[model samples]
Target: MDARLNYFGNQLGAKFLKYINSAGHALGLSSLPAATQELVKIRASQINGCGFCTDMHTKDAAHAGETQLRLNLVAAWREATVFTEAERAALELTEQGTRIADAAGGVSDAAWAAAAEHYDEEQLTALVSLIALINTYNRINVIVRQPAGDYVPGQYA
Candidate 1:
């Protein structure tokens, strides 16, 4: 299926993406763990139903040595035993953050406190930024009806 528009082909869209991608790269250099970052991206993408992002992040995570089992279980993370406490906290935060409209109060204090217990201030900052960034990307992709399953790991890098 063809996208409604080539977001990369338009000058304005390309400029927007350039800055967005730059911010993502800087966040990647933060104290947040790479594995955790990818997991967060995958979970948020799943929640948003952004197939393009789900494909991209899962492929990227696998290329970085994330096990297929863990990748497959991200959507079922709440019941999975393979994740660490820190990862679980992050996933919970991601869910709350992604589904903010569903919950009138937004991300709960409990989720924030749980994540705080696992991450430092800088890591938390990165996590928040990553969540926002991925959400933006997800919206853009979903609106454009971008196709999935052809992404190669590190294709954007």
Candidate 2:
């Protein structure tokens, strides 16, 4: 299937993506754990139903040596026993953050406190940034009806 628009071919879309990719690069250098970052991305993408992102992140995680068991369990993280407490907190925050509109009060204080307990201030900053950033990507890809399953690991890097 073809995308509605060739985002990379369009000059304006390319320019916008350049900045978005720059922001993503900065977040990658933050103190947040790499594994946790990928997990958060995968989970948020799943929740957003962005097949392009879900395909990309899951493939990226696998190529980075993440176990299939954990990757598959991300969607059902609440019932899974494969994740650490810190990861669980991060996942919880990702869910609440991604579904912000669904919950009238936004991210709950309890979720915030739980995540704060596990992550440092800098890590928290990165987490919030990552969540917001992934959501943006999800929206773009979904709107454009981007096709999935052809992403190669480190293709953008």
Extract clashing residue pairs from model 1. none
Each model's lDDT comes to 0.97, 0.96
lDDT of 1 by residue, 48-147 (tens): 9999999999999999999999999999999999999999999999999999998989999999999999999999999999999999999999999999
- Tell me the spans in candidate 1 whose CA falls farther than 4 Å from its real position: none
The Cα error of candidate 2 at residue 135, in Å, is 0.3
Question: Which residue segments of model 2 deviate by more than 4 Å?
Answer: none
User: Distance from true position, residue 77, model 2, in Å?
Assistant: 0.3
> Candidate 1: what lDDT?
0.97
Candidates in order, TM-scores: namely 0.99, 0.98
lDDT of 2: 0.96
Q: Write the per-residue lDDT of candidate 2 for residues 87-151, one digit (tens) a residue.
A: 99999999999999989899999999999999999999999999999999999999999999999
